[model samples]
Target: MDTQTQIIEQIAPYQPWLTLCGVLVLFLLLRATRRALRRRVDEIGYWLLGERGRLIWFWINAPGVMLHELSHAAVVLLFTPFGFRITSITLFRVQSTTARDRYGRVVRSGGRQSLQLGEVQYVRPQGKLISYVGDGLSGIAPLFGGTAMFAFLYWIATGYNLWDIPLDAHQNWQLLRPDWPWWTLIFAPYLILTVTSELWPSRQDWTGARWFMVGLCTCLLLALGLLWYTNHLARVLSLSTFMASRIDFALVVLVVLDLLFLIIAELTARGVRH
Candidate 1:
């Protein structure tokens, strides 16, 4: 076995009990929190069910949409003296203004070019060939920004560690890793999806792309849960050999599924020409 597999195998024996305890603690905590927030949660749920309330929620969160654009603007400033100006900044709206710099260049290619919040726009340069760099950087701002954020958060929580071992290591019914922090487990799936979404191609024509991404993320989460369950079952049954083999296989399958969905999404996005 490879080094990683060997290490995991060495650690596997301690996982079952630890995972179970972690689950029990997480469940109790969540139950307590739910009880505390029951009324407010119910009220918000009722509000979200109303069409007008849903629309208002979207509007209120609209400024988050500008984060990708702001990342691009920051990148632009690194390469050019001409700075970007945010014309407006509110929870519902963002407007930006930028001028060409002497250091930037223009491209004459006929790719889709427009000034959307998270899109790459090609502008004509006054005389230089370096202008397209800023646009290219802006176009990919979301991927870089989200990746940086994810990495930073992960580092802060885990201190460059690959895994965390739980305080309790005697229970064997839980599917999540015991080593990870409870907060990390809760938010990891969302982080994964957001990073994946940023890296994937943006489809302007097919509004279904966002939903498709959500579905893909859901599938990945389910796959991960299944894999964890299988491992847990193997441990509980003392089927170490089978567990060792199948866990790796299941991980490979999940990776393949993620890649396939990403490829299909990118192709679908590129097919939209307008």
Candidate 2:
């Protein structure tokens, strides 16, 4: 085999294991952080309007809402600030005075009991081409931010290299070891949580984008499942190994903690929105 081909073969077996370990670690860190911030999670829901607020605060601090508005403002500032007048940028909504002719609305539900909705009405400017940019940017800000954060952390931890293998032209077997940084092992769980939450499915009117994201999530879940299966299989194949014995115990603890934070965030967001 050529040098490149030989290198690829050497690295392939360990890739699956590395990816799975990273995911498991990331999930744990995120769950732990969520639990630590239980009170803050309540505040985030209030900020998102997931729960009802008395008066002004309801409009001001709604969870995940402000990011949406700032996204709009940012797009306008970058692309078309000339005609776009940002009237109000709040947590849940963004208003622009310039584009009065165009109309768009998005409604989101938090279970059957509560709903959160937003409408964007804009008049097309003299140049109609730039009108949609602001809307699109605002819609996907959370996903973008979350993914970027995770990637940044991963790069820092891994030195952006998955593995290292040096070889001479003779095609002889060279050093074989994963070159992951130590910090990656420490913060793997946080990275997984951030990426997963950012990539979670949400209601979007655009079917193409929605389905694309759904597919991505399915692939990720499958990868995680395969990792778990491999670990179990390894244990079963061994006569007296305890490698997979703790898998169930670890999973149950993680799932319970994950579900608790999810419920709290949903409830808080609902209360502020109402």
Model 1: worst 10 consecutive residues (lDDT sum) = 159-168
| Tens-digit lDDT track of model 2 for 100-167 | 11245433333333233233233335544344544445445556654444445545554442222233
For all candidates, what are the clash counts? 10, 31
The deviation in Å at residue 109 for candidate 2 is 7.1
CA lDDT, candidate 1, residue 200:
27
- Candidates' RMSD to native: 17.5, 14.7
How far out, in Å, is residue 216 in model 1? 28
Candidate 2 similarity to native, TM-score = 0.34
Q: Estimate each model's TM-score.
A: 0.34, 0.34
Q: Cα deviation of 121 in candidate 2 (Å)? A: 9.8
Best by lDDT: 2
Per residue, candidate 1 scores C-alpha lDDT tens digits across 1-274 of 7999999998888765544444455445534433333333333434545523323322332333444445555665566564333333232243332322334444343443323334333233543434444444455556677556545544444444222322235644333344646666455533433343333223431231344445557997787688687776454345544443443332332243345444544454344422
Cα lDDT over the full model 1: 0.44
